[model samples]
Target: MKGRFWPKARLGDVTCVMGTNGVGKTSLLRAISGTHPRSSGDVTFDGKPLGQMNAHKMAQMGVGYVPQGRDIFPLLTVRENLQTGFSCLPKSEHFIPDEIYQLFPVLKEMQTRRGGDLSGGQQQQLAIARALITKPKLLLLDEPTEGIQPNIIQHIGEVIRLLRDRGDMAIVLVEQYFDFAFDLADRIVVLRRGEVIENAAKQDIAREQLLSIVSV
Candidate 1:
């Protein structure tokens, strides 16, 4: 799968890729996260080509991926779902961080609830929380706000802002919602047919400008 409409390019702090449906946003993430291997091009981390690594290797190297559609274990309890990230860590460091719960308190209250029992927003939160437990350096989120409610969206935005402000992590977001992506992204990447059309900082482009890129 290749980026449609939106070209592949780099942005500041964030290498965001945006476009309409079927633009391959999810596929770009899949390639970067190593879920689907890239046909070419180099995905480098700390100056190393990511193509040389595997999924587990990528995680260990600090890339946390929260894919599209909130892929949580429907039957698994919230706690168990979080525990899944433990595989990315060594035995000594294998424990869900307290910050994870602090970041998404709803998860604390619904600890015993099955992932599928939660609403779409709650499931999305759980899915993100599960990723945060891994303590990634480069967090890859694919349409995190998709199908989520407004309040939850705000919370997620704050969380993302906090993570970015920390300055230790690099975030790559794939989004269709202009306002949502614009607000959270330090920079934006516009996709238009497996190619990067525009990549610039938030301060560099206005809302209308972004809308024009996504409008097909």
Candidate 2:
């Protein structure tokens, strides 16, 4: 994740960190997630600066990150993987809500299965479900459709649409798939080298323009 804008890194809104491979998309998300520290520029949420926030504090403040890899605990049962999200909440509030199942009923069906037993798409769903259990205001998704079947990709896209339509959360989608990103993104931020080369609303740009902007 090295590129042009290691010199300047700052983002907000429904920012899509898109570019050719190796343009620092993951690094940017990692920086925001506190998994990777910014060499410089501050990361903030809801207008409150992140100068004071660490990883645990960021989660408490509702920053959810679904990293590039679907890092579900393969040894744990599906239910146990979801429960890991509860560690962020108070003891009284530590339980999975029904809405999470509504978002992914496959999870409900496989609650007893070991995480390693699920398919790739199922694992992706579990990863996202794990993140949502924290009830974040800002969701960072990294190449969610990468390596999944088309049907599952559609489902994941629909889920993202539903979340964005709710309008309470700001989503940062880091993707290499132009078509998938186009369908769900409200705004497109194309990165080249590292700087934000083009930032435009979906209404303001076309597919070719977006593709060209991010093309190396």
Candidate 3:
């Protein structure tokens, strides 16, 4: 996770981390989300020093993570799966928001369906919806477009855009899909062998140049 870092992210911005496989993209997100321990360096959230807290603490501190695999509980109904996010909230705020259903209407259609029975795209949406239920100030999405069909990917992109434009949270998206990431990113950080090779505002870099850099 050691690299030349960017300035503190502002709410309403999307910071995309791009790299080839085995270059620690997922590892970076895991460390930031506290799912995996960082070997070195400090992590600060909301201008406060967060020194080696666990995942639950991170969640409570308004950090929501949707891991690479869209890890929804297989046996749980879709409604129950979303309810899992209730763990980090006060009991009074336990109800799922209507906006969650608006974001992914299929979830509402299949509320009683088992998570395992949903399509991959459906599950990805559920995973994101679950994280949104926590109402995070910082959302970390890792490889969200992987294995997703085009239409669903577009839908997810729109959802991310809406979330970003809402200006309530900062999104850190680790993506291998170049076009999708490039379109959404306000700033881009490129990594090679766990070190940052490029970090710049998206306007400062050309699409072709970014593709060439990551292709290597």
TM-score of each: 0.91, 0.92, 0.98
Task: State candidate 2's TM-score.
Answer: 0.92
Q: What does candidate 1's lDDT look like per residue over 147-193, in tens digits?
A: 99999999988888877877778889887777778777777877766
TM-score of 1: 0.91
Tens digits of per-residue lDDT for model 3, 82-127 = 9999999999999999999999999999999999999999999999
Tens digits of lDDT, candidate 2, 112-184: 9999999999999999999999998889899999899999999998888888778778889999888888877
Query: Model 3 shows how many backbone clashes?
Result: 0
Candidate 2 Cα deviation (angstroms), residue 199? 1.0
Better of 1 and 3 by lDDT: 3
What TM-score does candidate 3 get on C-alpha atoms?
0.98
lDDT of 2: 0.82
lDDT of model 3, residue 68:
94
Q: What lDDT does candidate 3 reach at residue 109?
A: 100
Candidates ranked by lDDT, best first? 3, 2, 1
For model 1, what is the C-alpha lDDT against the true structure?
A: 0.81
